[model samples]
Target: MQDATPSAIRSAGPASLETRLEEAARYALLRRLTPALRHHMIGALQPLGMLAAMLERRSQAPAPDMASITKKSNEMGVLSREATAACVGLVAWITPKTADAVSIADGVKDCLGVLETDLALRGFIAVNEATEATALVARAIMRNVYAAALLAITDAAPGPAEVIMQSRQEGDTQIVSITLKPREAEPMGIGGPSYRALDWEDVEALAKAEGVVLEHSATGAVLRIAP
Candidate 1:
């Protein structure tokens, strides 16, 4: 018998987030672009545009061969990375500062939403429960936003930070660990202390949202959800 279980789908790879964001920005710019200019821009961005459409279509299809899908997915991942790099390069060359600021801001927001949705999909798989999946997805999405906000606040903020989720079917519990490494040590500052303190707060809030009990320790953070 075929295993009916819904296997977890890993993230869309490193470039997935950035690529989606760039695509959003490009689309926004295209919309505002004059017909003549837009035609040229669209031609230049054909590869990225096609890849974006492919991803969207693939996402809607029923699960095909896992191995095949995964292989294609990885290819798409590579394409995403390349697309983002190209987009960044273009952005650097073409200064949009004098352009419509509102459109740019809106594009950024739209891109963020797309990225958040992609991340949430991963989070949903990380947590396998039906009732709590949405909550877990929401928490995951918020974590990304929070991390971004933290980064903006301080360029030197410690990074390579990650949110790790652990689940035990036997105990019917889920634990989410948020690991933080300080960018630099300051003389009695919020760098280390704040990170530690925030972990507990985040865990508790996540627990409440997901109907799970969370715990934190010196090593990392954990969110325990009872089945």
Candidate 2:
């Protein structure tokens, strides 16, 4: 039988080789960072301080728009002043290190945490009785974040894709599932296996980190999560 692997069929040149390696590296890095950042942000938001700051800011403004909120937060020399302060407090409580690495990571995590919590509290998500609704919203946000990060790192688009979200309730326990399908054919000159290859492990990791079960097959991918 002839080898079906992509490497057996094509020879990659210098530029294409560099691009492929860079894309793979970026995908791997984002996969690693997503869960860690999510956890850190969640931890940063646990303290009442960040919430209090958001509330205070909201109270002061007649109606805070996204731009206005972002502007005000930037003026404070942090993504969200209250969230940043809260993150610093938490970091101090945990790690006393004030190194640049620690500060930058914590700052970014706190900003993301505040943004996520704010969106949830603002009813941007349809929190229906069905758990699937919530999971869908979460999946959408995470995918958006993932796409944006990928673009930032690679200067390449991740393109539009369909994400499947499934929810089930049995007795009192709920289960959720999520899957991502590329909207377009995979690019040529990429992935050692084949241009049609999909990053199944990356998708699975993202879904699992979000507390969803992800399954993929020849037809497409499926995701299930609980409320």
Candidate 3:
């Protein structure tokens, strides 16, 4: 998996403060995602470790049962494939795609995959209810805006809630609405390692840098993207 850190900072000589802040926010998002990303990858590979240990014990037994060993081997094979797929999907978030254009549904799904675990820990649930939304837009930009929305909204609410994402096409633009629905519960406490909280200001700066139109509503924020 390639690092998602913005290369523009290294490639471009000097940038305005606005651009710098946007870059900082982008890097902050990646930092915030790192813990959950590592947790997820470790989780996917955990079963394989357990299975290997079990197989080792069985093989060391005085009377080794070939049938049982074969069954365990098959189970390991299935689990290995599943773990590989999960890792691949997670890696794509950081890796650049050959094709920049992506369907709104797919883009939302990918972003949610990265943010969902972290959001849950933060006392929020991210639901990508964006079926039938076929608007094609720049994948990376949309994902950055989505990450910002998920972080900013949760920060503002600071309690148990549901972040719903829905999309629709209006002429040449694709509108992704992230609405917050309240829940009667307290905010979760994720003790220990923590990352910088994403502010609304950060979200605005990121949107501006990516040329995405950002609008805040009573419910949440809306991102307007063009192909």
- What does candidate 1's lDDT look like per residue over 113-195, in tens digits? 33332222222111212222222223322223222222222223233322232322334443333333333323232222212
**Candidate 3 displacement at residue 84 in angstroms:** 2.3
- Model 1 scores what on Cα lDDT? 0.37
Cα RMSD to native, each candidate? 22.3, 15.7, 6.6
Candidate No. with top lDDT: 3
Point to the candidate with the largest TM-score.
Answer: 3
**Candidates' lDDT values, in order?**
0.37, 0.40, 0.79
From the highest TM-score down, the ranking of the candidates is 3, 2, 1
What is the TM-score of each predicted model, taking all chains together? 0.25, 0.27, 0.82
Model 2, 40-63: lDDT tens digits are 666655554565587567757877
Error of 1 at 209 (Å): 2.6
Residue runs of model 2 more than 4 Å from their true location after superposition: 1-80, 83-159, 164-166, 171-173, 179-198, 202-214, 218-220, 223-227
Which model, 1 or 2, shows the larger TM-score? 2
lDDT (10s digit) by residue, model 3, range 166-201: 988888888888999989887686762267777788
Sort order, lDDT high to low: 3, 2, 1
Off by over 4 Å in 3: 1-14, 96-99, 189-193
> Cα deviation of 102 in candidate 2 (Å)?
25
